[model samples]
Target: MSDTLKHLLHPKFLHMTLFGFSAGIPYFLIFSSLSLWLDQVGVEKSAITYFSWAALGYSFKYLWSPLVDRLPIPYLTRKMGQRRAWLLCIQLLIMVAISLMAMTDPASSVSALTQMALAVTLLGFSAATQDILIDAWRIEASTDKDIAMLSSVYTVGYRLGMLTSGAGALYIAAYLGTSMDQYNYFAWKISYLSMAATMLIGIGTTLWIKEPKKAAALVHQTSDYLAVVGVFIICVTVLILSYQLTADFFQSFRNQLFAWSQNRPLSATLTTASQLLLALCLATITARLVATTRWVNTDMIKDVYWSPVKDLFLRHRQHIWLLVGIICLYRISDIVMGVTANLFYQFKGFDLDEIASIVKTFGLFMTIGGGILGGFLVVRYGIMRIMIIAAVLSAATNLLFMMMVNMEKSLVFLTFMISADNLSQGMALTAFVGFLSLLVNRQFTAVQYAMFSSVMTLFPKILGGYSGGMVEQMGYANFYLMTAVIGIPVVLMLLYARKNQVFEFDQQSDQKTSPH
Candidate 1:
């Protein structure tokens, strides 16, 4: 047998694929599938868009990842080691959140939708936490040479998980709920309940797997744990107080802004931007304040937070800000339009099952193929080159959606659009993931990876939250055009990075650190 095929069948990669699936499942359940459910129950597009913010936990998961990194769970940590113990507990929380969501009927009332949103948000937090642990494990478990292969395997697993949650969930709902016109809460409930059962695959994997050597003996000082806990409490208190004090002012300001501009999307965007800035500023100040406390240990803070970040800046200090900008905006075009994709398909005359079969099932296979191709190209050529090409393809594919908007509602046309979009998305994501894996210093795997992953999604998700409003104000054609235009900056950034030798710097850093 070929070495590549032999490695592909290795138990290590097999475990990673399952972890990827576990991570992928809850993500689409919260974002893609939940959007469909909300729309099915007659929720307004604007409200459905806002619900996307429930997963903002992903964009800020770094704030809490330190605890996951250093602190040990009471009983669980003793049994399964740090990473696996955390994994099992988190998977349980995910199952509970999914079950709770299944019990709540969004079609019943506004309050019920609110309940469902909260449940989804809870699920999002658990899922994001799982991602942190899994990412850390993937990094720590592999050599530098094999990391890309591992990442590819993980992506394949993640896409498979997305398939289950996306197509599988939809099929179950369609099967149980025969009629499309009427609200059938039971059908949706059963679908979610089935998804919750799939968590067993993850939980079982957690039990069966061994912790990475690096994560197994992660002994930290007592003060480190207490300091993280203390700062967390401080940040939460400050955030809540800041919001309470400014809520009404922002509301009035938002109303006046909306009334004056008569642009719902712009007004909402500005309001959300202001609120996020204020909250982040307040949290930073509070965390800084706690840093100087007598009980707090500066060394602990430096090791946990500062060192990982410092390492990155030290490696690419010249292009750090540019690198950050690239990370933040690289996927903006895809995410902004992606949130409203199912809504668009429904409006264009496709039913649930057709969407499930074409968009979810068939499209996902295209995505996995693209991801595999991307991984191969990155190895054969280079990460930055592949990433640049991926960026162009990802942005350019949005135009396909615009064309679909004007075309007849034929299944063939829809399949073509979905195939192109999903393929581009898969390629872009694989390259991006490979690039990030290279950026991480294995010493601070969890925290560094979390920060990079978080930054990449933060801005895109913020813009995505406004997609529905954008589609409402502007027509589908214009919205897609805007999404496509959003890719211009990313392409430009990649070109600039290529010229500035950013990838060269990364290569030098890796060589210096590599054992060989």
Candidate 2:
């Protein structure tokens, strides 16, 4: 076996893989599995599609990651290490949240949807928080040369987790719910309970693994409290104001929209798109305003909040926005497609058993192979080079689903199409994760990573929420093609970044220490 192959199988990969599994399991339980559940339970498809917004928690996790890095749970911090303790606490919350979801029935009452959304949000928030710690831990654990190996196994493990959680849960629910009573709420509850129990994978890993020793201590002075409070109040204020503005605009736009389209599909899409754009604009403006505002607490707040931005700006210089733009657009095509994929499978006449067996199980192995190959390619040829290829292939694969449209649901055809799609996705995701990992500064790893992950997710999730409307308007064939076309810009931007020296793919982990 080659050194790359050897590195991939190193025993150390086990821990990262387990944590990756833990991360993947909850993610799909909240996302794809829940989508399947809600759709079967008679929730409106659009409403179920909108539930993807609950996952925006992952995008915003950076907002609190600084706290996770800076503070520790009172007693838990002493009993367990900082990252480990946070892992345990968050895992406990996830278990409880999943259990709560299991007990609630979306068909039970009017608030069933709301309850499900809240539960999903809670699960997502907890899971995203866990991710913050795990990413930091993984980076800290590996040497620069081995990061790719770790990244690949993490991808592999996460995909396997998805296979089990997504397919396994579907099968378990199907088999257990043979009786037809209000859409088999009882079986779903047990499946959720099973998901809750899977938290043990993370909990056990946290206990067994050693905390990274180089982790920094939070610097604090009594005067810093003022800055912290100022940041808290200002950030909260900005969010409140932005939300109010978005709500008013949404309502006003709705009233005026009928002049253009009576069905309101176009109006709804524009409104959703506008709200996302407005939120992004407000956030950027808030960052700028906070950075420039001169107050007694300026230095303190900047250190606490804007340090990551300053570090990145110094590295990227004037090209920061271009870099941000690329990251924002990179993963969106697949993500948006993912939001409505299960529904599409159903609409195309595949039953739950077929979806579970084929899409989830067969595609899982293809993804693992693609992800591992992606990791090896990154180690050998460098990231930017492989990312260019992966990006192109990733975009192209979405076109496969277009062929499934209005055709008979042949398992053979679905298998070949999805296998190709999953393979490309695995490669793209592995490269993407490694790419982000490289950019993180050890000093602000949690926050900067959260920021990057958030930027990557926010637009996609928001736009994906409107997918039901998009498909209703354009139909799946056009919508899938549109997703493929959207990915073209990523390839162009990457080539430009490489030419301009904004993209760095040749780093062996030696993480930069922040200048004190």
lDDT of each: 0.85, 0.81
How many pairs of residues collide in each model? 0, 1
Model 2, 1-516: lDDT tens per residue? Answer: 597677667666999999988888887887788888888877766778878887888988877777777675678777777888888899899899899999898878878777887798888888889888888888887887887778989998899889988888888888876222337888888888997888888889888888778554556653454445465557656754686667886878866885667867677667766775676677668766775655435565567568988898898777888779878998988899999999898788887778889989999889999999999888776777678888898889888888789688799999998898999899988988888888888778777888898899988888899998888889999999999999999899888875655655443211222133
| TM-scores vs. true structure, each candidate | 0.92, 0.88
Native-to-model Cα distance after best TM-score fit, residue 267 in candidate 1, in Å: 4.2
**Residue-level lDDT for 144 in candidate 2:** 73
TM-score computed on alpha carbons, candidate 1: 0.92
Which residue pairs of candidate 1 clash?
Answer: none
